[model samples]
Target: MKVKEVTFSYNQTVEQLKAVSLAVEEGKITTIIGPNGCGKSTLLELMSGHYTPKKGQILLDGKAIQQHSPKELAKRLAVVHQKNDVPFDINVERLVAYGRMPYKRFLHSPSEEDEKWIDWALSITNLQTKRKKKVEELSGGERQRVWIAMALAQKTPILFLDEPTTYLDLYYQFELLELIKKLNREYNMTIVMVLHDMNQAVRYSDWMIVMKNGQVIARGVPEDVITGERIEEIYGVKAIVDYREDSGVYVVPIGPCQRDE
Candidate 1:
């Protein structure tokens, strides 16, 4: 997917994204990282066809994203938003079956093919045992996996996740990231995600798009895009961009920048 000089705004006065452009490398994990309110999530939404840009275009497979029918788009891509809500109590398998809706006719029951995909999603997410369990009964990490299972049941080539690690504790955070990495490595899925943790972004992303104040400031591999000066510039924090033979590239933020600096 490619975003060509896109711009978006929630209201007439303030733009959320300003003349931004970037290409999501196919069959790789591309991460968007920046400080809070930097339009990371907004850009993801636009790429996933949830919102339209005021200017420029989002192209998928050489065609405009908006031109695709809703069901067609859903078949090509799946999205797991920052927060997923279920108003009523639902079991894992029932909820995951929703991903196959694109292939179903109005008021039609899930076909045998739909059941196959639903079971596949549950198995991949390690929720086979929880198939009959209520979503509310699971832990935060398990619940997140249920949402991902729903997306996986879509059987799309592309997946978009928005700050997926936000509310999870440290253990669950890494667990989910590992699962994401596994999906990319084993399945060759084209994954695009918005992440706030700089180190995690570096660890998981094959490519990074660094944004600031609603614009992309840099785009490249983690080692190339994230630097000490770049961190201080974008985040207003003094950080040490370091490398270790074992861990690859990582960042150590020492302190905040003073106003005068």
Candidate 2:
């Protein structure tokens, strides 16, 4: 997917994104990270066709994103938003079955093919055992996985996640990131996500896009794009990157930068 010269405004007054452009490398995990209110989630929404850009265009499969109908786009890609709400109480299996809606006609029952995808989604997400349990009965991490299972059942090549680690404890955070990595490595899924944790972004991402003030400041591989100088500039923090053979790279933030008054 490619976003070219895109600009967006929520109310036609202040712009959230300004002439931003970037190409997502296929079959790789691309992460967008920045401080709060930097248009990270907004940009993801636009790319996933949730919002329209006031200027420029988003292209998926070499065609304008808007050119594809909603069901058509859903078949090509899936989105797991920052927040999800199921109006009524439901079990995990039933919830995941919703991902098949794109392929099912109204009032139609699940075909044999739908059952296969649904079962695969549950198995991949490790929710098969919990399939019969109520969504409310699961832990936060399990609930997050349930949502992911729903997305997986869509069986799309591209998956977009917006701040998926938010509201989770540290353990669940890494667990989810690892699952995302597995998806990219094993399934060759083209994954795009908005992340707030710098170190996690570096660890899990194949490419990085750093945004600030509604514009992309830097985008490249983690080694090339994430640096002490750039960290200070983008996040107003003084930090160093520690590299180890066992653990890979980590960003250590010592303190906030001292700005001239």
What TM-score fits each model? 0.98, 0.98
TM-score of model 1 (CA atoms): 0.98
- lDDT winner: 1
Q: List the pairs of residues colliding in candidate 1.
A: none
lDDT of 2: 0.93
lDDT of each: 0.94, 0.93
After superposing candidate 1 on the true structure, give the runs of residues whose Cα lies further than 4 Å from its correct spot: none
Error of 2 at 13 (Å): 1.9
Supply candidate 2's per-residue lDDT for 123. 89
Badly placed stretches (over 4 Å) of model 2 are: none
lDDT of 2 by residue, 161-253 (tens): 999999999999999999999999999999999999988999999999999999999999998888999999999999988788887888999
**Model 1, span 1-261: residue lDDT tens:** 889999999999999999999998889999999999999999998998989999999999999999999999999999999998864789988999999999999988889999999999999889999999999899999999999999999999999999999899999999999999988999998999999899999999999999999999999999999999999999999999999999889999999999873
Where does candidate 2 have its weakest 10-residue lDDT segment? 81-90
RMSD after CA superposition, every candidate: 1.0, 0.9
